[model samples]
Target: MDDFRLFTSIRYDPELLKVPSLGFTNVGWNSKSSPFHMLDFHRDRMLRAAIYWDWTAAIASISGQEGLENLERFLQGATKDLVNGPHRLMITLARDGSLGYEISSLPATHLNNLYPEYLPNQSFDSDSNISVTVRGGKVPIKDPMYDIFVDSQRTTKSEFTHYKTTFRDMYNDARNRAKVNPGDKKEVLLLNEDGYIMEGSISTPYFWRNGKWVTPPVPRKFDAFQGSGGNDGTTRRWALERHLAAEETVLADSLVDGEECWISNGLRGFICGKVKLH
Candidate 1:
């Protein structure tokens, strides 16, 4: 697991420049066999149960030596929480050996928080997560960790719990398929549906042209294309200071061009600088 074990610097107090070698964990690949169709997720909750163990292990690892007692308490209870509560990976900012507050999930709906950017020497490829700036040295934070996008249904479908299906897996799976450029030591990106210009895979894409940024025109009539009130082009809403994108009739041909390409998925938003295709 050397590939899993990373050596890096962490910043607890920037003034002090305290960079500890922390361990961040990602879940193993979700069983892709479970297609996120309308009928599949509810039919099979047990199959997705493995993610619980993965989370527990990661929680323990994050609290290296000086761990967070309160957060650690929460992780200890996760096993019990899994059987009775909702299933999702947790993100913690570990310091010393203790963990930080907590970020529940990294679904496409909230990618802007990461503030992803593109670097020239940095790059991404398929099946390879072009090393983004993560903290710690254990698993590479696997799929579904922070790449899920949820859609709520209040007075809608009889089965509104479908978020347990559609987003959790699909969001991360797309990043799993991306490629990386070996030459750039700092090059990293996520590869979802958003094209090269797109920064996020599950969320959006970014392209640099004339020092300007552009995202993809969302697919119209998409499976999850609900209105703004409900679940619409979630990828378009990643950082929406102003909502410029919408569910329109766009084709694959429209993705190319743009100086540098990026994908903005759950864990990483506007991930510019990809070296591979979907």
Candidate 2:
């Protein structure tokens, strides 16, 4: 789960973001060759999602450019029938108003190019022995990794928290901590200074507590808690809109009072597993 560079950035390619001329449409796929494929028109959805999170400032600041053009370019290259496959698209923005993005599929096989021994082994398979670790206390990153984790929820927070910048120090640190325990894939559940369960390292945490499902509140003020800003993911939005979940502060002490818990991200919807807090 340690984050590392997967693909090098391409200088600038508009053609890479174009939709295929004869491929999947909103109604259905162009070909029946891939029967199990699903078509999701994500370009517009992605742009709207970014704007909702107020992350389009950098793109807007650019001269004669709309914020969504780059995302269109990023999705244009995903013409393959592997829509159901575990692929990840990353959009990174620099502090200097520079933007970079990459779209790539997760390798079918596990490959550890860096930090091979930094964390315990975890199965890539989704359903196998999934769990999450509750941070025993306020865990802050040291020296070089300090900025990797967002210590504040304010607009001035780390770029990683607001946008998926090229920073994975917080996630990597969480994975390392999870390795101390045993599970197929143990994520780190970060808590705020008030001991409220905020989010997982790479996911938004949800719980069924007090007869309703709720997600941790989005941090709006400066808090010493690291990893405060949860990604404004599509799944989170869906759950909120459909009345499936409400935004509320989930205290760590109330975790045991929940009926069940799960984590979600844009790439992967609700994970079908629970976090064992022992």
Task: List, in order, the clash count of every candidate structure.
Answer: 40, 1
**What's the lDDT for all of these models?**
0.27, 0.41
Q: Give the distance in Å from residue 271's predicted Cα in candidate 2 to where it truly belongs.
A: 1.0
Winning model by lDDT: 2
lDDT of 1 by residue, 1-278 (tens): 11121111111111111112121112111112111111121112211221322434434443333333343344445333322211233323222222332213222321112222222221223333434453222212122222221111112211111122222233344334333122221222322232212223233444444434444333222233332111212334433433322233222344343224434433332333333323
Give each model a TM-score. Answer: 0.29, 0.53
Cα lDDT over the full model 1: 0.27
* RMSD over all Cα atoms, model 1: 16.7
Instruction: Report the alpha-carbon TM-score of model 1 versus the true structure.
Output: 0.29
Clashing pairs in 2: 17-73
List residue ranges in candidate 2 displaced over 4 A. Answer: 1-57, 61-66, 78-86, 95-99, 103-163, 180-184, 219-229, 257-259
lDDT of 2 by residue, 1-278 (tens): 23321111211222212223422222122122221111222333333333434545533533232534444343454434444434555544433334455566542211111001111111222323222221221111111110112222212234344334345666556656655232234456665545666567666666665566678765332233544455444445545654657888766666552234555554433443344555
Provide C-alpha RMSD values for all models, in order: 16.7, 12.9
